[model samples]
Target: MIDGVRAILIGDATLTGLVSTKIYPVSAPQKINPPLIVLIRKDADPNKCKTESGGVGRLDEIDFTVLIMSLSYGECETISERIRFLLDGFQGISNSKDLDIEYETEFDSYSEQAKLYVKNATYTAWYKT
Candidate 1:
């Protein structure tokens, strides 16, 4: 799921124009520059819905978060918007599976320790196994 989401983000021209290939899973390496994206998978569980035969379905829902970090607030916002446009309400086949991604919520803040602006957004994605 993270791989598919990363592909969508890294494959975008507008997003790459802003941050290049600085998308990382979980955490960025130390000494890395700002204007990067971090992807975190919060949880992934089966939908728990019953099929017509009273069997569990093969659908999974993933809770994911994307964090955009930049040295400037405007840059962070630009990157966040680009990502939002790419992933929000996105439905397509990725990694040989049908996937649907939806934006949930977003929050913005400043990290005084890193002196960077941050925008964090949560998303829900459903896919068939």
Candidate 2:
């Protein structure tokens, strides 16, 4: 079974002592996926979604109640704030519920359930449902 989460990378001196180094889901490195958002405004069907036409893409919306499971147990509110802080670090995050965490570990608790978004070589977060 997979363990909980710990902090990933610690921030710089300016950010040190402000965030934890406890990476959740085993406190190891994690690989990130791709970033893309698709909306079904005109002709959308979940049964026939495809990647070529942007039907299938990274997750852009968060229910705010889903399993954003953290390995280390911080207060939900605190973690939420930390995650919110990461959005800008991920790049191109504008009023979006998107954020991606990147590491280099092969095994992950959220494997196949998350993707990393990048713009101009910057990190962005979007997960899969």
TM-score of each: 0.90, 0.24
- Worst 10-residue lDDT window for candidate 1 reads 46-55
Model 2: residue 110 alpha-carbon error in angstroms? 27
TM-score of 2: 0.24
What digit string (tens of lDDT, one per residue) describes model 2 on residues 37-62?
Answer: 11111121223224667676644422
Backbone clashes in model 1, listed as residue pairs? none
In order, the Cα lDDT scores of the candidates are 0.90, 0.28
The list of candidate 1 runs beyond 4 A from truth reads 48-56
- Quote the positional error of residue 126 for candidate 1 in Å: 0.5
Q: Candidate 1, residues 12-128: lDDT per residue as tens digits?
A: 888899999999999999999888999999999887667779988778999999999999999988888888899998999876667899999999999999999999999999977
Top-TM-score candidate index: 1
